[model samples]
Target: MKNKSIFLLVLTLFVIALAACSASGAESSSSESNASESNANSNSNEVIDIVWYPNESGNDMKASRDEIGAIITEVTGKEVEHHLTTDYAIAIETLINNNADLAFMGAVGYVEAKNGNDAIEPVVVPSGASGTLDDAIYHSWLAVDVDKQDDFKVDGEFSLDTLVDKRMSFVSNSSTSGFVVPTSTIIDYFADSSDYGDLTPEDLMEGGSLFSQVLFGNSHQGSAVNLINGNADVAAFCDNCVENYVEAADGEENTVGTVYRVKEGAAEPFNNVIGEEFILISVTPVLNAPIAANLEVLGEEDFKKIQDALASDATANNEEVFVPEDSDASGLFYKTDQERFIPVEDAWFNPIRELSN
Candidate 1:
């Protein structure tokens, strides 16, 4: 009878020990799950800093930058710190130094950044139409002042040869549409001698070379203004810039300048033209700038979050941010219209890289 009692006591002890071990395991699992949840919540609330290139400066853009920051915050569920760059070179520098997580850069800036530092990746590009991102190209124009339109005529037809020995203005030496493409076109067109085959980019910029005097107005708007004010006889600028200037004219009788078409053997030449209207002297297919991310600093998961957020319907449907408007509070990009941010790879900008080279 004593042995039977001992067996029962041993069995009771075994059951108690088993229950205790099971409870301990359940408690450990619960604690691990709670810790994971806490960490996730903490990460979701982290703020992300983004740098914006002040391609356009004013009180209007400052307000728009704030609004864009808010949109990125809401869409990505992370805080946003927006840094406005002073110039194009500074914008790329910020990314290279890892001072900023992302930047909105022109095609030339993108190429410069990619070449300078190999730690960047192009995230997205603004879409102008319903097509591939590669087709989202803009045109550049060589504009002449309204008063000097007759000076560029040859037998009453448009002639680029007339631009030789004329004072000219350009947006910037590194500018894609305003300087690079247009300058390359001019160099090729004016390559008459053996030296033309070996002319350097710096040669084109020198006074009394391709032009009598070369002036960089620093910005496209500034270049246009330089032409209007007679600081230059001709200006290298963008196609959209002319439209913006004319729209802001408020129907003034005296117009600003005219964009001319380049005659390079077209059967129907773009004739002598001047005024608010654009006559394409040379049209360059230029891709709109892109927003790139620093891959070394941003993780894959977070990068995916930002990419998804930017391409979301929320951003696309937000008219105030996507569409351009005249008001200061109307947002920064595509304010007059809506643009969808499409995903792009680094290879997408290879064409631009080649062009720059």
Candidate 2:
């Protein structure tokens, strides 16, 4: 009886040891799997970084950065980061230094990048472009408030002659549509640079030039608001901007209570800048930035993999994409085929440059 009891105790002890060993081994295996999975996830989420120039202030570029980052991350199964450049010129240099994989640029910024960098290329164009050229593809509206003008026609045509000595407002000095492009357009239009054509936003000395005075509204909307509030005789800004004003005017209670229209055919976002049904311009082409991969960092295969990942599903359609309520506001996005970056020299925009501007 004593021997049997001892044997039973020893057997029980052995069984408990075996069970503990098995449990420990299983726990070890689980820990190893978890470590491996964490590593794999980290690698999978690794992605490219890109930046955009703050063309329309830092806001527009910031919106783009958030949107692009989400799109790339979704498409490639990798991560993406879009940052805004504090300085336009430095952003290009960042790309050259290989700190970034892509960048979106405006016309002047693109020109600067193209002139300064050899690796830069035109990766894409806007969808509604009339052609591949650099000008006449987009236009701006030059307007005034309904209360201020009250059906005033400026000689019943789109002529700056009437604006010879009128106080005028521009969106901003850096604005492509607000100042630079339109200034150039107005300059070329009159041919005689003697009056409003010769004036520039830089000459805001208040009664220094043909434009009786000059003011800047800081943003496209601000410029339109200035016009609505009677801040200036004329407001030159993006054509889409005027559309919003028109929409606002149609409101029930919030209506701006205005009925402003452009010089017949030059009405825009609808009739084009010149109020013409289809005015073409070879103006400075609206530029599209490119998402590039550094062969040094990602290698060829991985680079292509990243790009393909982005092209497939990480594009503008992803929910993570940070798009503006009004930007391409109506469900517009760029296609991979159309997204292909073309060389700057290769760009050819559809523009009747002279007739349109």
Candidate 3:
């Protein structure tokens, strides 16, 4: 009877001790779960998505994507992610249709996207541009051989009538500043009872854009290369790209520059044909395809988060400059029509756009 009682007492103590241990464990687990939930709620601010990494020129797309992701994640305390696109044009189209969040399209590509969709906004231009223009931001220019600069008396301005039948080189049909804008301007130049005949890219490709012998270098550099190599007598190039030749040469005399200029304004005559500089085309956004967010897809707060992320020093500073500029592009880029990049309208670009279509 004594042993039985002792056994019952011992069992009772064991049960109480086990219950206490279980209760402590349950409290500890509850505290940990509550802490995790709090942290997750804090991070649920906003999220951003980009169509593709701007992997132009064979850059490491993932590294840039990550930098942007980190910036948004930190600033807005939102989870950020990256998306890739195999087709750049498709990406723009997707943005227009509100299928994607934001995209980076080229000069001409932007116009098409804008015409189709007006909900997007323009935010930035290049950093190196001084935003100085003699006429339009981007102008159509004509260049003769520096050796032939003496033939045109051009101090600051030039006319298209100068090269009626000379061999000319232009960038491929796909380019905005290179092929499309310049050709459209030339076509307009011929429309008003001009000495120069109307020309087509087909003609130019077949030796015909208001001239004879079309050498498709397929790139701005190719046009310059053809000019220097004596493959073509004349060349049409973007004003901005012309300096690259001089830059690449580092003043050692490469085939790139016979002249370095900021703008080639409206059509005018070169009075001094002797020792005159060749004309260069400066281009502006006629239809700037903005980095637009699908308002339908990305909520208002989320869209702003993406923009902030791109400009954030945390992101911008870390984001690799595929073509690094000497100065920062942060201030240079803005969403305006005239100040930084104003709405040039789709009609302004129709001349080029029509040809492209």
Candidate 4:
């Protein structure tokens, strides 16, 4: 009986040791599984960086950008960080430096980026129409307040030549529609004109020599505002901008300015003649602003993913992403007023680059 008790105690000790060994092995396996899962989650949650230049200000701009970022996060399954540049040059530089994976830029900005770094390429363009991206064109206008119509018009006809001794507001010198296009138009106009046929932009813009004074409004909207308030006699502006200003006038009659419309027959700015549109005048050839990606930062697979997200069927129909907060759709970014995004190639903007040069 004594020997039996000793054997039973030995058996119990062995059983406890075996159980402990099994428990430890199971714990080790579980730890490895958890580590593997953590690694995967970390990889999936990588962040994407984006940037844009806000041509306009207000809370609505922030709201729109946030909503777009949310959509991108949902589509790409990655965290998205967005930065708004202080100016057009900064926006271009953001892409050139590869600080931003993607950027929304005007043709002129894109041109600058392309010249600075060939790695930048256009990925998508906003379609103003549901039909095609090619339809997404905007205009540049030369406008004067109603109070100054007599100072510009001769016998009910608007004259571009009258602009020579007036106070003028121009959007940013870097602006495509506001400055580049309008200046190109003006240069072409005088270059081919009978009266000032031999003139050049340098001769025209010599510090109050082009007009009595030249003011930089710094924005399309700001240019329109300056013209409406009588701070300027003629303003280099855009089509959508003037419409928004008129609407903001709140039923005030005659707030509509006399706009210089570009005649279609102009061979170049030289052939361009001014007509009185009473609000918006000549249309600069439409500029299709684009969102581009830096090839060095965004892999081909990831670039395609970003493109798919913006062009996705679901995004096109999302009112929160595309719809304007106000009745003036033209005042909104995307200016398509929520139209779908379409694929675009770099060549599409080459004409703009040539014109800008």
lDDT of every model, 2 decimals: 0.57, 0.42, 0.43, 0.58
Give lDDT tens digits, candidate 3, residues 7-31: 3233333332211100000000001
Considering TM-score, which of the candidate structures 2 and 4 is the better prediction for this target? 4
lDDT of 3: 0.43
Report how far residue 220 has shifted in candidate 1, in Å: 1.7
Model 4 Cα RMSD, 1 decimal = 24.5
Which of the two, 3 or 4, has more lDDT?
A: 4
Model 2 lDDT per residue over 1-357, tens place: 322213323333332221100000000000111111112222222645555443322332334345545444444555655544444455556555555555554444444454455555433333222222222123455665544443434554334456667777776554556666556555555555554445443554345565677777755556655665566777765643344224423323211222343334322223333321111111222223334433443445545444443433234234323233343432123232322222222222111121112
The C-alpha stretches of model 1 lying farther than 4 A from their native spots are: 1-47, 192-197, 240-245, 248-280, 324-332, 335-338
lDDT of 1 at 87: 61
Please state the error at residue 143 of candidate 1 in Å: 0.8
Residue lDDT tens for model 1, 1-357: 322212323333333221100000000000111111112222223655566554444334555455556655554566666665446566677777666667776777888888877888877676655423433656676767544667877887667788878898887776777777677667666566563555556776767666789898766766766776677888877754333234322222222233333222211111222233333344445666777887766656667666766666566655544654454232445544445666676766665665576
Error of 2 at 267 (Å): 24
**Tens digits of per-residue lDDT for model 4 on 148-181?**
5677766767667777777878877677777777
Clash totals, every prediction? 11, 25, 26, 9
At residue 119, candidate 4 shows an lDDT of: 88
**Model 1 per-residue lDDT at 166:** 87
TM-score for all models, in order of appearance: 0.72, 0.52, 0.50, 0.72
**Collision pairs in model 4:** 188-269, 188-270, 189-269, 189-270, 260-281, 260-282, 261-281, 261-282, 262-282
